[model samples]
Target: MSRTAEEIGRTELGPRPLPPLGEQRVASDLSTVDTVLSNGLRVIAVHQPAVPMVELRLKIPFAGTDPMHAARAEVLAATLLTGTDRRDRIAVDTELALVGSDLDATVDPERLSISGNALASGFDTVLDVLADALTGAAHRAEEVNRERDRLVERITVARSQPGTIAREALQRHRYGDHPFTREMPQASDVATVTADEVRALHRASVLPRGSVLVVVGDIDLDRALAQIESAMAGWSAEASAVELPALPEVVGGDLLLVPRPGAVQSQLRMSAQAIPRTDPRYPALQLANLAFGGFFSSRLVENIREAKGYTYHARSSLEFTPSGATLLLDTDTASAVTAGALLEIRYELGRLGLAPPNESEVDTVRQYAIGSLLIATSSQTGLASQLAALAPLGLGVDWLTEHPARLAAVTTEEIAEAALEFFAPARFTGVIVGDADQLSALRGLGGVLMP
Candidate 1:
């Protein structure tokens, strides 16, 4: 006989003892990484004798303080691949094709990433071409114009989608007049960007002092460093500064409604601040988050989706970054039933604070978090990126290896304590995009509605 959800919830295999948490293990398998360079470029290289390919990730940090900058950065990154002084885009394409290599560039909030993968034999050529594109690429006016047109078209199409609209609305609501809130570039904004602006940004921000070059491959560290320095020797560090003011606390006790006409289902996003990556409570909180809403078998999924069929999925997690962090919960439900779903969400949050999870629930969630962490460490490429990313944020080399033990050490009582401090019913914020009339119905559940 199939067990009902009520049975599953109440079925407690009593007195299941948990193993004692062990010491944090440092990953000795990862090779020693060093930082130095010729000319003024900085480099971090790892020698993986087992793999024949190499990956180089370069960060360029001058794109925008407004939405306009976002558009400009995208155009500049695209233009990098179009050509250089030595080769046209087609010529470069032919060379990569011959070597079975891949090269691309992308822009993020803080920097531009230029990465390439190629056979060990052709690594030097790939590096030479990439360096040329970075330091002396021609930012042709014609290519800039074409990129601008393409970006404009993309923006127009993105804004028409309901999901994009909902996300944009949330950003404006959460980070008013802040750069972090900017999601996409506007057509008008992209059209106004000048080629000179792009050139100046490339010159000022994509230099050594603010950049970190990560190379992972099968090669001698000394030779790899030499090859990188020979190419970037002429490039010098430039003045680059980013002053991100503290984001204001997200306003709570309000319902943010964005009416999407003719919509059948409602998308709900709610969030509040969580501890940062460097916080001591991170491991415990991560485990608790997974149990609550971080995975497929989370409390949110069990209570809201699997049992009640209110939505297809529900999730929650801490968005960690260098500057700060936030805990976000998101799901979808029928527009008419949105209020009922939110009430249940609030109820669950309240319940988690009051009742500690039983032994079985804690053990299952702990095992899942540990398994996920282990999986994240398996790939050399992924491990290298995570290590590099965390090092910048002051996390130690032992962070990953030590994480599983820390997660295991978290008691149900401690998780309940974290929930009390982290999840605040009074401060929770909600955003809804659906029919205006339907959103109004939510006000009866007790909160102010902000349009």
Candidate 2:
């Protein structure tokens, strides 16, 4: 008779240690061609041959000083492709379908972004439709009116959401009167915007001088550049795109409480000033954040979610902009546990600063950081999106290619220093939104800043 399977395995060998990570290798083979058109449109084409599809991203600086600009831009983005001089909405849709393409437009405080994809063979057709909309978007009275009503309805619904309320409250508390606070415009302001105003805003604000276009796919880079140039030649303006003023630096202090009279759950939000990607210490800080709370296995999650069952999720991440960066921490929990969760979160922050990560902790986060970067840029759409996002910051494909090495080079000592500087509990301030009755528990926690 044969020996039992378990007995054979136990006799064969004891438990073995995991193999060490192999030497780092660059996985991306993307080669790019960068060019500028006569009308000042910056075009970047990357050759990625894994798929027969082309991904496109257009970023236009769309900032405005008028308080009503956000509301109007919201409407403009919704109705921009509804109709063009050459094609009504139906015709536009039909043409895009023929090419297996789709395009979407959205505007935020920083830029108006257009992203889409199509078959590599249909790249020219996609570009043609894009150019026509860019130059000849009719902003038809009927389309604008219909979209404006829809926007108001959506805004109304969004305002009723607890998350939206918390975000709006946090932004208001953080920025005060800064234009960035207008991320979601007042429904009343949106209600008053007229179609004519959206048309005029489009005419004045949409220009090519400060815009960037990134195209990625399996195609001849030179031919793609020529096609883009010819297609967008008609889309021009005498003035450069409007650039927003710098965002104010975030200052951290006591937590602010925003009461929601009788809610069952509470939203916890916190943010601290952070270094931009260009900063020399950014890679170390990135690793430090990961070890603290940036991933599922981080200390915050291990403590609050796994150990205490205070929440199902806890995470921290960096939000980058052309002007600056902020590290944000978010979690939601039952109103009863809200105070306890906050206290534990502060404890983790203090622990990270005081004790820092050991060699094993640093190694795990470093591997995760490098691995995530490679995974994010592994596809055509992913690469295109990453490049487009970095373009406004004057970074390019090289930055994407080289960042993994920086993450790998970050030493344990560097991460310790970054943690002591950035992860201190006193470096964060935020708002807590919960039921007023339940928040009595938080009063004893101290450092509560009331509005």
Candidate 3:
């Protein structure tokens, strides 16, 4: 019998129904933890037994950009996994491969972090290897030179990219004379760093006292603590606070425009200093900023990108850190509309303060902020990093658990207050990367050009 037309039509396309707007299951609630090791290592163990894999993060107040005297700490941290007293670099990597584990180490501006994941049963082995590398690894001169050259290459490449250039410019503008202005070392500087400098930084910074070990997986608190203690027996260094200057209050009204010549699009960035992570107002500020430009449906996106189609992407963020908070607003658009875009951004900032968002806008934005936080922490690494980042700042364990309630209860007045407190429409440090002629048009918008 010949196939009927209805049969063919039925098979070709099923009934078309609209997909749901968002996710069905909210993320699992944050892992509750409380404990501190005898050696003063803050241990927050989130026992997720369902997964056979475990993640560990050891964070010390040591980073490459943090020291003016030397790059030793950074070099040591970077080379931690490269080799050790018991194992050569090749042997260490081979061991990791055999265990089906991954190891990564890096030195940020304020923290030196070592993170890894391995099978729960292989935890002790991994920890032992990591401790060995941390305690007795040699910073070979050849390796240091190689890494220096590599970093210089990376920086050179970054400077060529418009986005990186904009970010670098933004950091310089926001920080001015502060240590925050100093970025990762360049090749020349890295090459000049002696091996002794790296050793000194390691001895001073990456020690048991200044570090926190966060372990999450199948291990119980007791096992986790014992394993870590056994592994880190030889690791001991003096407790020292990370030397950091209080971030300078962003002086409103300084506009810096970095002109990128012969460019089709202009990168726009506006940032100002705000509250620190421990500030009580931070939770409210986070939610308010979400409504302003922190999310896709935010006022900045709705006004500039969605409504006017000025650019492809636009977002803003309230950066919470140990040092302090920064309100960062950024976007990229054609040079013709660059000035208009900044104006719209400025208007958006002012609007948030001038008028409270309607109930629906407020609720929608609040749900998003809370929901996004829950979802982001679902990963072991994500959760570990979040806690590690917060621990040194003294943000309590309940910060995540109490976040939803705080976000839900945020008032319109508080939202407006946070907007006023953080976003300075009049005092914006501006950066634009485009052709010199394209930048001339921004002069009327009030900014100084740098050659």
Candidate 4:
């Protein structure tokens, strides 16, 4: 009554061969103006007319080591556009809506980001509102009070989440007491933040020097540049925005098993230092990571998730910062299979280095990488985001336009070397959070430390 997949494929012209991926297309160069405003803001404007909308991404380095910095930063971001001298919260929202625009502001340990999009015809209106808020945001007492309360509630709930628990454990294990580890402020800290503190932090940290603004869409480069310069003339700071201190190099050793009293599953997070995008070997490393665990069909995902059912998914990716980069591998599994999953991950790491990707494997990942880049840049917002991300590293459209060729040039031999150097099991350190009683299997695994 039923036939197995193997049996069904056997009669279908002997197991169907997968179709070959189509040839990759190179992305065109963007006409861009990369300039520094008189007030010290780095502005990158690109004319990408794929659509009638313009996208804006403003990145301001907002790092700080003070005990209250994270809480105040959170509160400030939440209330940034709530009001200014010329307009109140409702007025700001109404004007943006009239121009078919939407904007949002968020902060992390390293930076404050303002991202938005608007109809190209309303570009000047969008810039006007952004400039108004940057120079004159009031951070009114009522607004700050409301957002601070909300932040506390959100942080309280977030702390109880397993993923949050795992992330905190991993960050602590990697860098003890580093400000970067302060991904989210404690609820108690947020509850104590005041409007005056928020305003003071804004004046001191929300600066222009060393910050970047990326504008991309169907707009003239010269006109956009002039508009941005005129709009932001009054938003100036004598001091540069703060930069997060360099992260301590993650030394390779045993995976730390962080105890969670009644957890049902284990969250595994591991990291090791790696080269930056500027390195010539980065393309090879990218391919190696993808083939190992960065994609669904990779060795780790196939072995642990598809074949063994140890976890739903596994990912190995490169995390970049202006200072450097690191390779991070993440997955979650039932406590019963945590050890097996770690073993498979390490085994695959070793296998990738020793066996190397063959020509066929390299070709598949190469195509995927090239195709992914093309698709990502196929949109105005995507292009703007990409440029914004690269701006901090002093790269721009040239690097993006030339990346496909670089990836195409990476060889299997190079990828294998990258895999060996960067993904070695001994070079990785991490945390596994789960019930102490259930993860006893990891003790005998020899690589992980049990609490």
Candidate 5:
């Protein structure tokens, strides 16, 4: 007589402990070539033969002190590549479609960035189009007017958003009169931008002397270099790119309250000074941040979201600027729980500093840190974007390859020290935006600056 199927399943398929993870081997065999063009454009090309596509990134330092610069630059980025000397908008779009390529341009207070990807065989076509836009972008009057109107409308909508209001208020409180506050230009300023003003900003700020170009894909190094040189030969500028002044460190003090009438929810934002990636203690700090509030399993999320149901999400991260870095923590919660949430957040910050992570906590976050870094760089597009982000800091492939080792080498003592230094509650200051009636209870919490 054969045994029943249920009897065999219970006897042979009992639960058992899973095996440990095996050793992981990260790929470090990428062949890279670096060159500086005669006109001072630095190019870095990495050979990645797994796929038949090439990723391109171009970064131009576009900083200006003029109050109207941000609005003008915003318009310039929108209209850039709309039309060039050799191709109108339609022809440009048609050619890019033929080569299976799409490019986009964006501007921030730091730089103007262009990123795209194309078929490996169509690399030359991509470079030519890029060169043409750099040299001959027409900034036609009609396109400029249309884009300006659209930009004004978009800005109006964004300003009405809770997130936008919180971010703008934070910047103003943090930087005072610094140029970084120009990140969110006033709608009035954008409405006044003329086509001629955009053209002038482009002529003055789009030079190549301080720019970087990064390409990653399946291609021969020598041939790619030759193609880039030939395609960009006609693009040159006598002036170097503008450089902004260094940012001042954030001053920590009482929290500032921004009134939002009838708001059902409140946005809680906080910031503290942080060290740059180049700092020796950064690896330990990164792991410490993960254990505190930088990941899903962090103490902040476990306490505020899961335990108390104060919010659906809570996160902390480091933002690296050209001159410095800042640690930011943000979450939104119901108005009824805003004061309680802020009190708990302060408690967690103080706890992290007083009683740092234990050995088990440190080990878990260290593994996550290393694993996430390796996973992010496993694809062509991912590697290209990472390289481009690091280029402004003068970092390259070597930095990316060696960072995992650094993360692994961080000790528990170092993490404890980093927590003590950076996670203290007195080291942070920020703004809270909510309805006055809803946040009247916050005044009793102490250290709130009312507007």
Candidate 6:
């Protein structure tokens, strides 16, 4: 059935009414057990019941200052579960297979994380295996050598990437030689890490004190807590895990030009200070960030990508670091257009602070913020990961459940104020990674430091 042309023509044609936003559904006040054990590990257990499986995240404060710490930490993560006094690699893999479970470990500048999932009934086996490795990992020489080779290959490849180069430049430009700046260790450093060094680092830094373990799934909260306590009983030390030293504040100034000769493209990365999720004003700032560049509909994307075709993508978001929350904006463009892109980016930043978002824009971003959080915490793994991230910041399920209401209560005026104070162009500094020869136009634009 189709309307006649005359009938269609007679109807007033205007924008269709935007659909009403769906109800902002937040997580229920589920029963949770959050407490510290005798060994000083904070354990948080919750029941999601979405499936008969459990998700686990163990985070240990693994920060260090030794120049070689990053290399040894990487090797330790790679070979942590390969063998222990009680079991070898083959036996560990066999038991895990029988339990329908898998485990993986990784390290960054701040912590060592071991993440795993298993069928609810087989969760005990998973924990037992984790306990075995925590107490008795051998860090066998062969296993160490194998993992070290892989790290070398990955490091070599990563160092050659433009994104990695830009990240290193921005990190150094902001934090200097801080341990937090070493997101990736140098390949040369990794090659020298011996099994003995990894074993030593493990003994010194893998203590359960100040660490956290999170479990979410279909299980009795009490039973899960008991099991974690029993499994992690042997993993303790008198000394607490080392925490990273606080980072210096990021101050605003001229952008550094990091020259990469003959490069066909350039990367621009910028940062400014921002409030955390725990702050009362954070809800408003979240919406302001989205309206600025956090989504496809943001002002930054609309101007630089949709209208001017300066870059393929542009993004801005809040990043939580050990120091505190910071706002990061990034984009890449052809070398010839890098200067123009930076100019437009700065113009949009100034406009965001001066003009701010109107009510309609604020409403759209509010809906987005609410919906995204709901989606992020909808599944067991999602909730587990969220809890893991928030635990370090002293936030938990209450914060998760009450966030929607906070987002709903922020007004357009609050959004305007947040935008004005936090999005000012003068409050940022960063680095530009590109061929210096193609970036002369940036000299006239004026916040850029010519190479």
Candidates' TM-scores?
0.87, 0.95, 0.88, 0.96, 0.96, 0.96
Score candidate 3 by lDDT. 0.73
Best by lDDT: 6
Model 1 alpha-carbon miss at residue 83, Å: 1.3
Q: Where does candidate 5 stray beyond 4 Å?
A: 1-15
Q: Give a tens-digit lDDT track for model 6, residues 214-233.
A: 99999999888889999999
lDDT of 2 at 426: 91
Local distance difference test, per candidate?
0.73, 0.89, 0.73, 0.91, 0.89, 0.92
Candidate 6 has an lDDT of: 0.92
Residue-level lDDT tens digits of model 4 in 245-302:
9888889988888889888889999999888888999999999999998888888889
> RMSDs, each prediction?
5.3, 2.4, 4.1, 3.0, 2.6, 2.6
1-451, model 2: which lDDT tens digit per residue?
A: 8877666556346744456878666655667987788999898899998889999999999988789999999999998888898999999898889989999999998888999999999999999999998898999989988988999999999998889998988888778877777788888888888879988998898889989999999999989998998999999988999888888877889989998888999999999999998999999999999999999999999999999999998999998855889989999999999999999999999999899999999999998888877878888888999999888888889889999989988999999999999988998999998887877878889877644
> Candidate 2: misplaced stretches above 4 Å?
1-24
Count clashing residue pairs per candidate. 1, 0, 4, 0, 0, 0
Candidate 4 steric clashes: 0
Higher TM-score: candidate 2 or 3? 2
- For candidate 3, write residues 200-226 as lDDT tens digits: 666666666656778878777677777
Candidate no. 6 TM-score: 0.96
lDDT score, candidate 6, position 433: 98
